[model samples]
Target: MTILVVILALLVGLVGGVLGGQSRGRASRAVLDDSLQREAQAQAERVRSEAEAQGRELRAEALRVREEASRLYQEAEVRQGQAAQQREQAMADAARERADAERERADALRERGETVRERETLKQDRQDTKRERDELKREIERLNRRAEQLDARGEKLDAVEEKLEAHEKRLSEEGTALQERVRSAELKLYEVAALTPEQAKEQILSKLDSELEDEKAIRVRAMQERASADAKRHARHVIAQAIQRSASETSAALSVSVVPIPSDAMKGRIIGREGRNIRAFESLTGVDLIIDDTPEAVILSSFNPVRREVAKHVLEALVQDGRIHPSRIEEMVHKAQDDMKGFIHTQGEEAASSSGVLGVKPGLVQLLGRMYFRSSYGQNVLKHSVQVAHLTGIMAAELGLDVSLARRAGLMHDVGKSIDREIEGTHVDIGVSLGKRFGEPLEVIDAIAHHHDPENGETLYSVLVAAADAISAARPGARREELESYIKRLENLEHIAVSFPGVQSAYAVQAGREVRVLVQPDKVSDAQATLLAREIASRVEQDMEYPGQVQVTVVRESRAVEIAK
Candidate 1:
């Protein structure tokens, strides 16, 4: 306003000086000044009115947001109440359906009063007591099977809930990202709005800022509450895009390293004179050389991939050199052992480079290289680690965290898997020790220790690493659980179900995918049985690690029989 008035006064003064005397020019100047002042005051008043109107609108919006929140809260409460009532009604209806069965079991049930009242009959009934006990035991075994079925059904429900949660989480992440974009755009618009007479605009904006402070605080609190409640699901959401972006072609192949030769004659050469050359190579490399009937290919079998790899290298070199004598086999085996070190080192370097993680120790790098030959659940460990690193880095970048640290953590998260077969402790424990030995950051070590259990993690990076690891493992064709592990999971499922109170027995069927739990009907009420199924499913989710899904089922039964003589 001051600048505008100054320019206008300069123009009026020049015009008045040219057209009028000094006195007349002074009077014109005074009139122009008064009119200009009045106009400026009127403009200021209009601006003030506009600012006040905007403030009112903002206040109205805040009120509206609060009202909407309240409405949502009330609606959620109503729905929960309705759901509770429906569950109760369902429970009541089920109880009524089981009324006859319950009545039949009443006399046999533990009742001191009935026992005393039927004391005279009890002596006569003693003869059939043993038969009744055997029958009761069989009934219990049958009910246990029923419980397992219910447990399986509950597991399916849990799987459905997991999918729904991931979908909801994806939507939530999209919404949050969109909100960030909108906020940035708003800031740019605000900058543009302040271009003309910045002081005036700033004055209004300052008032607006002051007014919004309370609202911003309220919103921040609400967002924090939501974020805390959905931390794990949100973690998954952060890496969803990363999973879609990942490209991994590595697959878990059979453990046996097949060495191909030029022809069947080459196999005879590998066998050596009376097996001396072959025996020498096996002794040095600790790998079995199998001259199989499979055309021109021979099999190199060893439980240790490193040893098997060395044997494969040595055998191939001997075949190429056309020297399969005992002396030649020993020399070739020694050279192959030396070459194995450089090969694994190169592999480790390539893995680090692929993962975009630098400054790794030589020892750690070698460990990482070992992972190329190591696998778990039929998935390549080094490749899985690299994929995890990509995913973790992406999630960290999305959340505006330390991307390099996150990537490093992800790349080394499974380093223990490389030596876990030879080590004494779990992969997680070994990974943590390796991280510390390699001078990794505390965050990296923490993430390595807790990537499989995010709830125990202390840092956001742990959550990111955990999410990334799960995605890498669970991706299509990423990993295949071996038959032994599959069977073990089934056994664990049955064990877990049977361990629960009132469960007579449990059987894991459907190829380890489902469990049938039979519960004693007298001990477990219908409602309790339902809750037990859910509990068993939850326990399964927490205690076990299995691909795809496991369903748990619980079955309860009560029957009455009458005989006429």
Candidate 2:
């Protein structure tokens, strides 16, 4: 730009000089014009060189800009490639996730297949059981036929015995007639011989008396034999008929009930907030909640069957609801208690219907239902009652007594057991009271009061009930005391474990097969805990008797907790 300006100024100067020379000397004018032309040409050459350098500089700047743009384009392409790689990586990640999902699905399907196979195995086992039952039925039928043959033979023997009794009676009659004729002849001889009348009279009287005693003795002996035969035959028939009319299956009850959980992790949830939930549940339900290392299971233990049942329901509900808190525990406990009433009613009704003892008052039925939870010597009281009812009914029908009255008496024989723990009396006393309160017949009440003592039975029906009760109670598997001993042993184990030094708590689980003890970490070291377990186990072995073996576990734990606010 500067060079162009300078060249334009030189043109203007040359034009001015030419105008002035025209008015001056020619030689001066020529010199000035030459000088001016040379200056103009130099200025033009300098302008051209400067412009070319400027052009070169502009071209260099453009080239630099183009190079910068090329670098930017390269960077953009690299970034695009990086983005594509990232996309590929993400796709790979997605594929891996999909693969993991497929694997999980496959595992689930495999587990389902195994479950199906197990289900089929269970079905097959049931079929095998059915087959065994069928075989038992056939055997029973064969025994029945054999019994019929024995009965026929017994009848024949009975007929023969009757005939012999009649023959003996006729023989006694002929002997009596012979003795009378002898007495008459003796009297005549006494008169013909002219013996003293007083002496003959005394001799004849003594002889006749002796002869009469002998005849009476013979008749009494024959009568006793016939009576014995008759009594034995009748008892056998009555017992056989009663037993044949009844069938039952039952097992002893246990003190603890196990509730299944979704997972072991739920143990922590159930023992919430420093075990407030568990403590609340135990207090509300009157049950001991034994949460141990037993996988996916917890035990609710109480000597009271109803309380244990309620605790079981509460725990199951809490687990299914997945909300375990003290308040929720109390709520569930109340709900379970309410449910228990319905359950008890249903059980009572079923017992009545099954035992064929109708017209039981609702209140009486409720009491009967309570007996469902009550057990005597490890026998379920309600079930025992039903079996007794069946036996009594059958026997009463055969013995020409009131069948319904007998059944009712038998079914209610143990009704007092329902409240035996509540009221202050023996079951017999409570039962008699309840029977009267419910308007039971005199025979029924008498049976309930004295089923344990048949000698006190007031009527034939009461006697039959007592007999039936004896039969039902005597049946194999109907009663057991092992349950009580089993629970006692477990309690004894816990007691022993808790007696140890530094032990905080002890729980007997695995049906008294194991005892878990928690010890204070500050008082008991890890080594001490091990020794404590051994000591507890030794104590249990020494002080208690249990089936199988009892495992003792002592846990000493130290926990650190902090609150972040």
Best by TM-score: 2
lDDT of each: 0.84, 0.85
TM-score of each: 0.45, 0.46
Enumerate residue pairs that collide in model 2.
none
Give Cα distance to truth, residue 490, candidate 2, Å.
34
Query: Model 2 off-target regions past 4 Å?
Result: 1-227, 481-565
What is candidate 2's lDDT per residue for 1-565, written digit by digit as tens? Answer: 5665666687677767766765687765666767777876786677678877887887899999999999999999999999999999999999999999999999999999999999999999999999999999999999999999999999999999999999999999999999999989888987898887788788889999999899889889868976975786577678756765666876578999999999999999999888898889988999999999899999988899999999999999999999899989988888899999999999999999998888889999899899888877767889889999989888888888888888888898888889989879998999899888989888888888778887877777767877777667655446664445656677788888888779999999866768899999999998888788878877886788543456888888899999999
Query: Which candidate achieves the best lDDT against the true structure?
Result: 2
